[model samples]
Target: MRIARLGPRGAEVPVVLHDDRAHDLRGIAPDVDGAFLGGGGLDRVRDALAAGDLPELEGADALRIGAPIARPGAVYCIGMNYAAHAAESGSAPPERLVMFMKSPNTVQGPDDDVEIPRGSVKTDWEVELGVVIGTRTSYLRSPEDAWAHIAGYVVADDLSERDWQLAESGGQWSKGKSAPGFCPTGPWLVTPDEIDARAVRLRSRVNGDPRQDSSTADLVFGIDRILYELSQVLVLDPGDLVLTGTPEGVALSGRFPYLAAGDVVELEIDGLGRQRHRFVAHEDAPEVAGA
Candidate 1:
């Protein structure tokens, strides 16, 4: 099943997409959040749909599509998990995972405008496969155990400012990765039963021109291994987001120019859906509360 949220930012309504229509999920849960997922919300939603209890959500197509899940508690990212991406960044594929964190506040609607940080000159884009946690996970005994904790998958754009990430980070990448709206995610949260996750095509474009074109099958460390390795060091709770990493063809490869104001980025992963957003100058961008 495909789950989505649609409306103005911060006031979106949860819904299930089936038969090319949106079915209201307000009666089933408050929002498509951790409480809902960890509390058996999907099962309840399936039952309701089977019984014809969910009402059709009118005007859904005209509304903005918010990130499929509510604000995540944490946004974990894997860097250089793709061999080609590692080579592009001037590094050999790591024997261990290169992980980083993006503040949860970076989350934003899939189609929202992104701000180019003040005085920034190396802003870039990354198209990644995002995994959402459905249950509290810690110390799993095996990699296969990850399946039971996964809620679903979504498309994620891991926007970055390369200057701060490499030159001024003093060794930490989050400095460039944590800007507000740096993470634009989801047109839908597709359940595992509906996608292979291990072998889907993911691609990105800049101003309608192709940039990145790759597949999850190219990942050096697969989904199961990523989750299993993460569980050994930290706890991942429901609604937490894990970006499995982006493929090559980013500006960092020196093949394309970095993003500037007025540039549009489009990203898509087969089955999960697509996202498109524009970059605006910092002064012209909307003010983000508590940013």
Candidate 2:
């Protein structure tokens, strides 16, 4: 089943997407968040659908669509998981998994305006397949168990600023990765049964120019291994998001220019969904509560 949140940011209500329409799911749970998923909410949603209990959400299409899920507990990312991406970055394929974190506050709706950080140059885009965890996972026994822990998937743009990531932050990528509104995710979340995370084609475009075009098949370390490997080191909780990494074509590859104010970024993964974000100068954004 596809799930989403609709309304203004911070006040989004849960809904289920059906045939290009949204059906209210707030009666089933407050939101399609970690707590709801951890407490057997998906099962409840399935049951409700079977019973035809959900109400069609009126005016849903007119309301703003927020991120499919609320701010997750942690936003983990895999670095250079795609072999082609590693090659473009002037790095050899690593023998083991390389991971990083984005501040949870960076998470925003798919259509939200992305802020180019103050005094920034080299801000970039990464279109990635995002895995949303459904269960508490720690010390998982085998790679085979990985799929069971995933709740669903979403489209994620792992926005970055090269300056903070590589040159000035003491080699820590998260410094550049965690700016507010850097992570724009989801028009909706698609369940595992509906999408193949391993073989889907994911791509990105800046303004109107094509920039990235690749499949998850190029990943050096696929989902199963990444999950198994990470479980050994850290506990992944429900509603935690894992950005599986981007492909070769990105601003970081030096083939394209860094994103500028008023530039539009569009990204999509086959069967999962798509996202479009407009880049805005830092000074142009209004001050909000979280800022």
Candidate 3:
């Protein structure tokens, strides 16, 4: 039930961790992903698994883990999906949910270090619960139908630049949010059968101190409604990701204390898992050879 994508960038393989051992679903059944997700291949893998025909993938600490889904077509995001977060940012709950997109290239492993872009300031963090779509959908009208298409969940951090987001660009939020490596995603893409997304505990700590602590219960739009809302405007595809949004304590939500160089930002969501990244200051990068 807990499937993992292990190995380094572009070399990852799907493996399921069962009973303290890593089951290499791909070993016995080469078509693991397609089969495991309820496709024709999925049924074949299931039948094989049921017959105890899969290979063992246990106890490999050296395996580098990648995001659960590879080649996610898009990374859609929600802003102020948390009621209190909206309030802290000096805004009212909108009549509708707010959305944005991060370049897919921004997606990286959950534990990857978040690099601070050169010539930038206002790097802030928003720890959010990520929803990955299992199938394509467009024009959905009800909340209940949303879950049927969701593949599972992952931990995502929407790193932002306040000034570039609000002031410098003259008001386009994506400019500040879409920087390369700005989005750190996944310890894994958990299937719903393994964890309860709604009951999860979410938290963010900066350099070992608690900052954003909340529950999925605090989300104003939640998953079902968010999918329905987004589907109404644009079509969502397999491997598309939705950021359910962050809760109350982001530095930009106005109490002002934003991130600086050398800060370590960490986020944890109950079953989905944890992610840590260091804030490297722009000035610290070595000067170019011909500068």
Give RMSD to native, each candidate.
1.2, 1.2, 4.1
Q: How many residue pairs clash (N, CA or C atoms closer than 3 angstroms) in each of the candidate models, in the order given?
A: 0, 0, 4
Model 3 residue runs over 4 Å out of place are: 27-48, 254-256, 282-291
Q: Where is model 2 more than 4 Å wrong at Cα?
A: 288-291
lDDT string for model 1 (111-220, tens) is 89999999899999999999999999999999999999999999999999999999999999999998889999998999999999999999999999999999999999
Clashing pairs in 1: none
Residues 60-124 of candidate 2 have per-residue lDDT tens digits of 87988788989899999999988889999999987889999999888888988888999999999
Candidate 1 stretches greater than 4 Å from native: 289-291
Q: Write the per-residue lDDT of candidate 3 for residues 1-291, one digit (tens) a residue.
A: 566677766667777666666667675443223234535433454566677777876555688666666656788999888889989989887678888888777777666556678767678899999988877778886889998888778898988877888788665678888876677877767778878898689999999989899999888888999999899989888778889888988888667578877888899999987888777666653331100
- Please estimate how well model 3 matches the true structure, expressed as its whole-model Cα lDDT: 0.76
Give the Å shift of residue 267 in candidate 3. 0.9
**Alpha-carbon shift of residue 158 in model 1 (angstroms):** 0.6
lDDT: which candidate is best? 1
